[model samples]
Target: MGAWSRLKGAFTRDAQISSPEDLLAQSRERRSGKVPVTNDSALRNSAVWACLRLRADLMSDFPIDVYRKVSGIQVEVPKPPVLISPGGSEVGMKEWMYSTEFDLDRGGNCFGIITERSGVIGPDGRGLPGRIDLVELGSVSVRGKGSTITKYVIGGKEYEPWDVWHEKQYTVAGFPMGLSPVAYAAWTIEETISAQQFARDWFAGGAVPLAELKNNAKTIDREAARVARENFRAAVDSSGLFVHGVDWEYKPIQAVASQSAFLEARQYGATEIARFFGVPGDLIDVAMSGSSITYASIGQRNLQFLIMNLGPAVGRREEAFSRKLVSGPRFVKLNTDAMLRMDPEARARTIGARITNRTLTPDEARALDNLPPLTDEQYGQFDRLFGPRSAPTPPTTAVPGASS
Candidate 1:
């Protein structure tokens, strides 16, 4: 069964997990439909690592800045984990969200433990949470009341589930547990890893000669055997030759395994892993010899990637952060435009189109491109570029010329 289906079935089968205390114990035990994707080494595969890095870096570049609706327009908010850093440090919101989403993308679950700095308030008057800090899933466990998860246990301390931000992909068991792609696609990843290892081992040690010398007449004496061994070792290791006399025959060994097919399988597995992660095959340098997806142009492929793959992934985070980080009309949205942002001329054309269409004002388009609004004189200059907007005055009356 597919991982999602299996997860659903297992959750439904064990629908009786209602007791909060019991859930803590049950969570410690293996839950139904749980599959182990592998430990953290999942990123060791070059293709997986490349895809994940691309996704994470792309999403990260799309800022997760906070905004609130005021009189129908969204305004930036000041309070955030970091105050001024741009590229994002350990405490920066972008870095945190980027890493968290990386985990969700790869392992299917991402978590954060609320800290006092998070500013999240609890229902109780005195006891509550204010903010959250990203926490590793390995350090946290989920416990529930009935089918509903109530709390998460980290180390020995227990905190309400509401206090912990959990972002998951391929969710099952009431959204508390996630089904990892790595787990469901374990066989493919394993095959890729194996192939990689095989290649490494081949190049590392395959330098040795693949043959042995045999005495035709009889088994050589110890001295003769020793000399033969030395000669064979020198020939194979350094010179790639067989310097043997009569009665000593060298037979090059042949591999029973089909190395070519194995290598081809490895290449195939890389693309399959990329597919599982929704990455374009060509993005990872996989030969799309038979792929129908046209990678004809870099721009079009990137545009398609934004619309088809990265857009949804970024949207999920936007929703999650909107729900968890802010309340009411306020929302946290990633600047997805940054992902597919075109060159200056193209961008100007786009914004000009929007302005012409009246979907955006000239000022708003300028703002979107981070340009300040034009001054009155600058506006005149700018409008003049479109040429002679105003009509020329008619010729002065003949009387004025006569007076002169």
Candidate 2:
């Protein structure tokens, strides 16, 4: 026989002690002086105690499947004939559909049995401090899914089909799976069986009733939580708020920005930009609420305008241009010193001249030194403010009514 089978057989056999407590007391006595109790002892003690507590609750037999059929009856009738008027011909109609549905619910029950064995001899040169053996008999239920179908018919007509969806159920009987009841019984009978071995090593090494073991498991769980938090924080810090698994660089940002820039230009009453971008004025109105600029909305003509009129060309490739705008040498120093230095009226005059394609006055030129700080927010706003004028005018550049 295999070691497990032999251990099981030994446990099933009758023992000298009559009660479970007596068996425990005997096992402790046998090991009292021979082997010092260690952490392993505590675990074993806990398991044995747990088994003792559950011994009375162990199930002797578990339920099994007893398949049975459930019958369903369906009935239908036709309404009496009705006429809209006395002269109208009678009209008849019959019930068109009738059917039933069936399904099964199945479940199983299981139990566990534990036993121990031990032996010791006196100091008479004979065998002493004999081995302790632990054994367990697990009762498990196995079930499988099943199905049934039935159909019925009425005179010269077809009816709906019915089906019974079968589910599996199981219960332990005598032993789990194919094991005999004797083997199941043996798990509760052995003397040297360690409760710890039966409950922990023999099973899943569960850490029940042990604080340290539970804490260790918790520590691992906490570390996992920490790592997840760090990863999420890093992601948010780099890219701002976003939906999970969405590629930030390619998706919603560009889409939203394009939509916003178009809407804002229209809000500023820039019909040319709206039409050039192929977006309606109302859509531009909504997009303007949030500050953003879409490169797609800014055509090549608009980029060219900014490069030629506002800044020096840094670089250019086919269909793409990069420009850099610099303030006067002393403008940065002036901004650092004061905020209310520039008069709005004078600034407006300067902006008007620039808008009207005229040269700046001496006063306006010096006032440019007080230009406001250029932040991303301000830049985005300026794009909406001035972007429309820079947008390409299709009619001006087009040969009227020319076909491609």
RMSD of 2: 39.6
Query: Estimated TM-score per prediction?
Result: 0.71, 0.11
Cα RMSD of all models vs. native, in order, equals 9.1, 39.6
For 80-110, candidate 2 gives per-residue lDDT tens digits of 1110111123211110000000000001111
What is the clash tally of candidate 2?
15
In the range 1-404, model 1's lDDT, one tens digit per residue, is 54445444444553432222222223332344333235366678787888888888887677667889899888998645432232134466557667876887776777776555334432333333344567665566665533566666776677876567677776654545665666656677777776666666665656344567789988778998898788778876796967556787777666446567677887898889998888987887885567666654456678898989888877777787666555456677777767565766777787788876779987887787588987889868867898655654567667655655
Best by lDDT: 1
Deviating ranges (above 4 Å) for candidate 2 = 1-347, 356-367, 382-404
Model 1 lDDT, full chain set:
0.66
